[model samples]
Target: VLCKIACMSRSRFYQSFKQKLDCTPLALQQQLRIENAAERLKAGESVSQVCFSLGYANLSHFNRRFQAQFNMPPSLYSRKNISH
Candidate 1:
């Protein structure tokens, strides 16, 4: 849909997006989702709620991505933030 709106093929859009952003579209999406999820978690949302609300059906996958991005699981991150 975004590609259609931009009047470019998927591959072309990905190529241009990567060139401009220095990351692929999927990477950007994952980064954005993780960042938003982290914010919500810090704002006092439960990990499971944030995971599903962010459209991640697999809790393990969400945990791994969140851990990779922040070097800590969402639960730990949220707890640490709340303690501070």
Candidate 2:
């Protein structure tokens, strides 16, 4: 079981995983969105649309975290995606 293997009660496991992974369950689910967002950006989805689709309630927070993880702004990642 996820809780047992994770070595915590269900609530504690969820909380611990969230802190460890830097995101909630839904947010982790939307890591799939991050992958898709990157791909869609490569194929030419606008950044704002990607932001919304990824459920970024705050566009600025999305941009900040994306930049933090990838070491460049999403726009630049998009451009780089185009080049590569």
Candidate 3:
């Protein structure tokens, strides 16, 4: 859909996107999702809520991705960052 909107083929769009952003579109999307999840978690949302709401079907997968981005799992991040 983005490729169509950009008036470029999929490969061309991927090449241009990578050249401009220094990352693949999927990587950017995952980063955005994890960032959003971090904000929601810091706001006191539960780990399961954040995971499923962000379209993550598996809690472990979400945890892995969250850990990869933030150096901690979502539960730990929330516990550390949430206001008392």
Candidate 4:
């Protein structure tokens, strides 16, 4: 639907998106979700709240991805940033 609306083939859309953003759509989505989660966590929201609010269905998966992106668990990241 998005490709049709953009008047381009799916391949062209993906190519253009990658060229402009330097990341795949899924990668961009994950980065944005994690960044938003980090902000919410710093705003005093709980880890669970951030997880569900960001549409993650599994806590462990979210934790792994968050840790991979930020090099710490969300709880620790929140605490470390909040106390500074």
Off by over 4 Å in 3: none
- TM-scores across all candidates? 0.89, 0.61, 0.96, 0.89
lDDT of 1 at 45: 92
lDDT of every model, 2 decimals: 0.93, 0.79, 0.97, 0.92
- lDDT measured at residue 28 in model 2 versus the true structure, 0 to 100: 78
List the lowest-lDDT window of 10 residues for candidate 3: 75-84
Residue 71's lDDT within candidate 1 is: 100
Candidate 2 lDDT over 1-84, as tens digits, reads 688987889899889888899887767765676777788788877788888887888878878877766788789889888734
Return the lDDT, model 1, position 5.
89
**Scored by Cα lDDT, where does model 4 land?**
0.92
| True lDDT of residue 26, candidate 4 | 82
* Model 1 superposed RMSD (Cα): 1.6
How are the candidates ranked when ordered by lDDT, highest leading?
A: 3, 1, 4, 2
Q: Candidate 4 at 41: error in angstroms?
A: 0.3
Please state every model's RMSD to the true fold in angstroms: 1.6, 4.5, 0.9, 1.7
Backbone clashes per model, in order?
Answer: 0, 0, 0, 0
Error of 2 at 52 (Å): 0.7
Better candidate by lDDT, 2 or 3: 3
